[model samples]
Target: MYKELFIHRLVQSKEPNTLPKLLEGLFEVFADFQGITTESVSSTLIDLTFLEEIRKLSGNINIAFGKTLRDIKCTVNDSDFRKHEIYLRYDSVKKLRIVSVDLPSSSLNKQTYNTIEDVITAFLKQISNLQSYFNELENIDHHCVVMEPIKPLYKDDYRNIRIDDKTWLHLEVTPDGSATNVHLIGQSEIWQDKLQKGLLTWDQDKNIVENIYTIFDIKNQSVSPTLIPVDAARKQSSEDTIGPTCGICYCAQLPDYPGLPQPLCQNMNCDVYFHKNCLFQWLVACEGGRPPAFGVINGSCPTCLQPISCSDKDC
Candidate 1:
């Protein structure tokens, strides 16, 4: 039953120009399978890591308003070719409402579906579980957990979580049934001050901690950590010392401080540390005397042109 329905859909969707070639390939694989599953339905495949998907969708795709269209994509699940996971996408811009809902095979009843419409109906039901990536955490009543630690049992569960247009959180699980701590750019020593200047730029008065909690929808009433101590991280500069200076105001950066909002150069090779307000002023100045709308800047590093949201080597 599966093979018959599967081949019918394939023949219908193939380009008329290549019917002969498509049929040739289909015959070669036909004998290898006792049955076919939903994965055999569509050719569209996306191998995007959870983070890559978030970054790609973050600011690049504008979903605020547009004509709405939706599509469902079935990808070859890494675990099994005989099984597939369905992603129901509702376009918010050219296209963007994306969510992951783990639906079991039994829910789709692939073993007994009599028609293609039955297959589509199961995929469409995923709409009820869709989670928006564009809405603010507080608005959705969910916390934006910046790299929440993943337990062993839940290791496979963490999706690449995004906090804003620039912030990307990485969740790593360990063999010891533990997970890595949440480490943001400037706060981590990975970039090591070649100069990650003013990169992780937050607007007006928003600090990393505040932004993470507010962005991730971390409940204001609940306490969850948002920072991890990176090895050899540069600290608030001492005014008496002449080590690192702010690129914007030329003021010395404070060293060895906790929860400070001083901006780092983010260039990874420049020795510039900045006060949050100073960077804010510099960003505003770059925008040609125009104040940032809604306290957000089109912030990219002046030297590297990289997203100025974190000082990590990767960013």
Candidate 2:
């Protein structure tokens, strides 16, 4: 069933661009659905109105067929043109529209069409793999350290103990230099009843005052989540514009510093920066605990959400 179709103006090209070639290429792909050979599909072209709509939908005019074109107007070399916005519209049945537009004489050549066709073919192949494409989108919600915390210095007095021959004692020194140690009196049930929690004393400034200890209530303790500010992200990037910015935070600006851990996202378009400590905590928070370091792969730019890749050169 043929209906009225519209085509938009072609983009000005130094050589023939992909628009026309893509249309021709799609004819082959759609032929199977229409039960016809590529040659049998009519090459009938449409008008400028169609092109205008296409420009509206996709920000870029250069796209392959089967991709929905939006309604919009675009300017090429100061000339106004309209392109079809949506190409594939389904109401009750599927339909394909073809539009004809002028190609620059200087830009037209055999090679240009072939290149355009190749691009279209590749794009179509990707489209055919719908399940894979969706899988990628589904996987995009990921967490990574845009910034890692600098290791806090530990006090010299604190020492780890091997409880029994199997279990090791877990010890933590507080900011005030007070040490909290959990000891295993024994593995047996009777010995477990004899276990006692130990605490070291500290002065007003939090310095160790004495070795006198007491049992600690380890079960009732609550820790607060660290607050990460947006400004910190910018500061890191500002330190070195050349370095990648944090994907979680977008505040780092200009001339990246050396020796600092590389940022998560570096692309100028997505320019997000993060503090090392902030990022590490964020990863742990998102996963409900500290996750293994190796699981993280790619990270998204905090600003644009576009995936950022590691680069050898500074941004």
Candidate 3:
């Protein structure tokens, strides 16, 4: 009975020849599965190379510019690096986008970013430098009268610097610190014609702030005193009533003038002070709306009716 049971169990297990073949086939199947897994892991490593580098680079960036590093979004391509004054972000895994008040998405050259390390390094360097430039622009915006706020004056990157009523400059500052594009737009055809003929040129070596300030010479000029209202002027005048009042506005200081009313007349007999701007406009109106030549307006003083010449430069 034990021998019969043993034989029954052996038969149920397998035929010996068939069992070896089945074991060999199973081993081959397992080998193929292992090969497939190895190949998949190798492919995954190749794909995760960029991912790993980016993750490591992000760690470094978080350490360096922790304050400027506003947010790290877990998206495919929209991580932000916000600042109080500027709008900056990573437009992609490899590109940085900078958007300021009026400036557009200025990107560095593609060749500069070959690795993830390169991308982060370049972005941090650019943003660091931009802080100084942005400060300069803000200073100019608040103080400089020769130029309006640094804005895209024309299509694309051309900036406008208005030196005077009729004279301006269209300037383009490159993001990569390359050569700048500067074109002078002037008051008259002669200036434009000279620029076109290459007779008049802009010096690229000069600093932009220096160039604009030199054009109007506002750097050495002092900030104008705030406009004194009628009651304030009267109150101040009660204490000190020595200063000459403007012939036109009847105020001690004009709102937009850079300084006190100029003694344009220069005649001791008249002794009437007039804001250069007011005197110029009055003289221009008297002369049938034709401004005088050579930045000098030859007209009689309104109070004295004496021949007086006012320089437009003072205006």
Best by TM-score: 3
Question: Would you list the C-alpha lDDT of every candidate in the order shown?
Answer: 0.36, 0.31, 0.45
lDDT of 2 by residue, 81-124 (tens): 32222122211111221122222121111222222233334333
Better of 1 and 3 by lDDT: 3
Q: What is the C-alpha RMSD of each candidate to the true structure, in Å?
A: 19.6, 22.4, 22.3
lDDT of 3 at 29: 41
Residues 51-134 of candidate 3: C-alpha lDDT, one tens digit per residue: 345445543243211122221222111123333232334333344443332233545443433354554455555555554344
Indicate the worst ten consecutive residues by lDDT in candidate 2. Answer: 140-149
- Per-residue error for 52 in candidate 2, Å, reads 18
lDDT score at residue 83, model 2, on the 0-100 scale: 23
Q: Alpha carbon lDDT of residue 250, candidate 1?
A: 65
What RMSD value applies to candidate 2?
22.4
CA lDDT for candidate 2: 0.31
lDDT of 2 at 292: 44
lDDT of 1 by residue, 16-124 (tens): 4332354354555465555543245332321122113322442312222111112334433221122234444532222233234343212443233322234345544
